[model samples]
Target: MAVQDSPPVPPNVATTGGKLTGSLGVGSIVFMVVAAAAPLTVISGTVPLGIAAGNGAAFPATYVVCTAILLLFAVGFTSMARHVPGAGAFYTYVERGLGRPVGLGTAFLALLSYTAVQGAVFGYIGAAVNDFVVSHGGPSVPWWVWSVGALAVVGVLGYRHIELSGKVLGILLVCEVGIVIVVDVAVMVQGGDAGMSTAMLSPGEFLSGAPGIAMIFALAGYIGFEATAIFRDEARDPARTIPRATYLSLVLIGGFYTISSWSVVSAWGDEGAITAATDNPEGMVVDTAARYVGAFTGDLVQVLLITSLFAALLSFHNVLSRYIFSLGNTAVLPKQCGRSHPKHSSPHVASVVQVATAGLLIGVSALAGLDPVTEVFAWFAGVSTVGIVALMLMTSVAVLVFFRRSRVDDRLWNTVIAPAAGLVGLAVMLYMTAANLPLLVGGSSTLAAVITVVLVATFLVGVALAVVRPPATVVEVTTQEEKK
Candidate 1:
């Protein structure tokens, strides 16, 4: 099929009235993406579950493997970043390499994935905070009540300038990560049952429990790494900054998860780690902290876990806002949403819409009387992972196609080899995701099928729109940047 005709865009059109400010550096961008991954939450919450349900002692290796796969994916991903310019990340790359129709379809998937994951975080944080409050003699309140309150706070932050959000994320990310690092160190120094060793990293251990399930868990932690490109327009020196941020985030996030998880395995000893995780998955990290660190530190971790969820919520909020803003810019959404805030240089309209959508989802989920973690969080997370994996596979293919035609760079590694490798790797992961969908989402075949159908339906709707809707007509606007 022929590529759909996109409206003519002027050279200066990208810098027109709605442009977000270019003040974020590599640090800022990395912080946002990594925070979206929510290091503490994963290490404390998911790691235990992964160990129990997946490859016990070798779970840390899963992170390493995920990092390698993404680094390979990034070879083509960042390569395309040099040629394509936009805040749409996968949407822009796919459109450039694939076609306008496919690009628009990918955009829909992007929105679905990010929104689902963000809503999942909201559900988790709501239930967590509600429990925390009641445990401390606070007023008894519904989980959705906390969720709505959080939505209000996040909406205010999202409506402000991008830097403000970045700074807030930075602080939260540091606290969450710092506490985990401290706990990891304490565990190592104390040498619980087994002293530190390279045993967990071994292939034998890595492949031990259900590796497929472990891989799924590991992939979820790296969900937001691709957001590096989404922030390209708002980042300083897009070409240099985006690529650096992508690599930096993968290394930092991957390294942190691997090392922290290894510490967990070491604390209980390989033989007993699995049993410990199985017995009390929820307390794996908390119990470790209390044992090695102190009771006070364990309490601190519980508090930080809530903050970690908040960081993820805000980070995803920013991501979804930008996706809407970019779609608006291309006429896929309301023109008003295409406009940036005159004073804050933020996607205020899009942010408001995101908050509203989140509120609706939260409300519906509450009305259904579903368990926050089991139904709301698990189901949404499963769908989001599938969508994200599909997008990654498509984008990797786009990278190869774009380079083959344009020959933008002469290096075979950058243009062809890496993209091909990434394509294969992502294709495998995509299969794993699909195969293990039920396991990822609480083992309900019906729930998994429902989520899968939703994702497929969303993509079809995008395709139908691409086929039926008239092509967008590009318009020029005078360039302007609001002062910081």
Candidate 2:
């Protein structure tokens, strides 16, 4: 079927093999969870620590708040996705729904966010590995080793077919989720040493911290959902599968974070929860497991933590590469960027670009004498949040615009109102991020903060370029062979 009526839908679009099928059932949904949630491997104790230092037991409640907000955002985001199917995600949504200028702006920002996210994961994986190495007392490998290792692994998987990447990710997802459930259940069985506390629900708990810190970190857990469209070509039913993945990802993340946070609180004994979390955020789960379960089991959880972060790196690489590929497909990029690997059926050139950029950034940071964890996680993540925040704002607006112009009244619920709410919610998060940019990256590292600033400025520059000279008209990307 030709995309005659749908401007955003390319003409001559086909049910292409390269495109993800919509059979995205529970397994696909679960793969998303694995990608998005595994990053919590590094986030778990870290978020609670920020809370302990700032909020308290109430940190768990904050996770729930983000869950609701993201759910609202998904309503709009997914609603738009149904009409506009591409790996560019928010960028495509805003471009078609809004104006080209706005669309390109969103696209550029998303590129920043996705690429920065990949960069951020590099540091995170390095840190996870470093943690493991240091714990072993074998004179921990420099963080660069972790970065290199991640590059090698992510590069290899990305060089192959999506299914191979999916399989590897599926295994990691299962293991990570298994560990998270194991920790939560183990804590529950052990019971609270001092009973449940009211702090889990108190507003005062969240208000106590520089609210920005908690909100920003909480936002980190939601990053992988941006990849929802990455599987579009593989989903069973694009229209249905994409929307379901959107909602499923949001709900699963929110619930998973909530339960995990509460389990930590329960393990700590109400009053001491946050403080204990602060003293040892990365170690909190480990300590909790050791306390309630056994040393052997706690050690196992720590090992899985490394695997979880690695899984996150792998997932984000795939997401970012596809984004690159999408940009190339539109001829908005270098012709080479859009080319798929003839042998592997992968976006080889784009994949290499992502790996190279990540390596260069990580390597330079390490050589320049900086902590990869702080530089990678705080700097790139904070910047990406800002960029994604912009996407959220544009997406929310696009939802309203698309429905406003189109005869599609079905979108009033999911596409219009809910997305509007999400936009508002994300805007609040962005305000918080800007106000507390320094704090997001520890507010302590001048270098990290500087790096973030430069990145944001560069994004603006790209937006400026798109304004000066817009990209050529998008042509039919799929072919007759693809339709067959």
Candidate 3:
């Protein structure tokens, strides 16, 4: 039976009343995406955890494996970038390939995932800043105070202009990356405790002892790189910029993670690294800095960790705002959120909503006297990881089906084979995430199940919305006629 083709929408349709204005080239986009990953923050916080609880010295290899899978995912991901240039990104791609209901559901999932993760950062950053100040004999306020203030600052940037956010992220990202690189270089020059052996990258190390956990942490680090397509409206020559940025960001993120992690393992001697991490997971990197470089540099890295979290928060705010704007433009959300700043050409309304939503959550957590890192950050970050992995799996399949149905490209690897490969890897990761749900979200089975149910229910709500109030017109890839 021949599949009937859906009518394609006009190419480059301005769904939002006002288009986002920016000339963000590859470098700008890379900074935005990688900043969301927050290198120094991840190394100082997440890496030690991975080393201690995950695969030990082999943790560095997990990043390489994750990177390889994502690179496969990106093969079809970047291919679809040329076909669907909408800011909706996964939503647009899935809707065009699958259907409106699924697309709408994916959008809901995307919003929940990005917002949750962004909110998670606030919890951690607030705590970090509060500790920094109190330990330094400064005024002591509740962590939520810092979280709310940081939210306000990012809210302003997100509401203003893409270039402003880009420049801000650029400066923060450089400092964060530079500081980590300095530590890495220092470790290398000293030849580490184990004399700089390549054993960390060995196959035995990579395959040994619960590598799945390490891979989860590694995958979380690379989450924001996929947002490259979400900025299509503001990209300069998106067809070229998006693909280049996608690959560039992936490579840079992967290489940086691999090297930094390996250096850390070497710093303590690959054998003792796991013990060092286990002993003091939080301050392993800082302590290593003090020992390897100098006490001053160690203090500097601690300070940079706060800025790293801030950079990540701002980057995520931009992404979540765009997601809200895309839904609003499609009438899935309030029309007000669809409006952009006339002068700044940014998603001001959605940005405001982002800030308001985050503030409300912070207020609730504060009132409840919840631990920001354990209760707020852990739960949201875990759920977001699950949601994102699911989205990636859907997107990989969407790429394959879309290309097959449209027959727009005759190439096999770009459309079919690579996506198939990517889907398999993503599915495995999704399964691993679900299996480790309790561990990911504070080790409470009941809590994990509740969060899982919420994720499922969020998608169902989106599906119901699509059925109850259908879009006046469904958006799809441009047909030959529409393109012309």
TM-score of each: 0.95, 0.90, 0.95
Give a tens-digit lDDT track for model 2, residues 1-484.
Answer: 4442212332222322123222445466558545755745634645566566546677777788888888888777777676665667777777777766666666667777777777777777787778777878867778788789878988998878777777787787777778777778877876776765567677776687666667777777777675776667656666777777777777777788878777878888777776677677667777777887778876688777777777777787877787777766654566567677766667888889888988888888788877766666767777777777767777788878887887556746775678778878888987887667777677666754675666567656656766786565555444222354
Against the hidden true structure, what lDDT does model 1 obtain? 0.86
Identify the superior model by TM-score, candidate 1 or candidate 2.
1
Q: Say which prediction, candidate 1 or candidate 2, comes out ahead on lDDT.
A: 1
lDDT of 2: 0.70
Displacement of residue 65 (Cα, Å) in model 3 is 0.4
lDDT by residue for model 1 (32-74), tens: 9999999998987789888899988888888988899999999
Which residues of candidate 1, in runs, are more than 4 Å off?
Answer: 1-16, 474-484
The lDDT of each candidate is: 0.86, 0.70, 0.86
How far residue 139's Cα lies from its native spot in candidate 1, in Å, is: 2.7
**lDDT per residue (tens digit) for residues 284-311 in model 3:** 9998999899999867987999999999
Shift of residue 391 alpha carbon in model 2, Å:
1.7
Candidate 2 all-Cα RMSD: 3.4
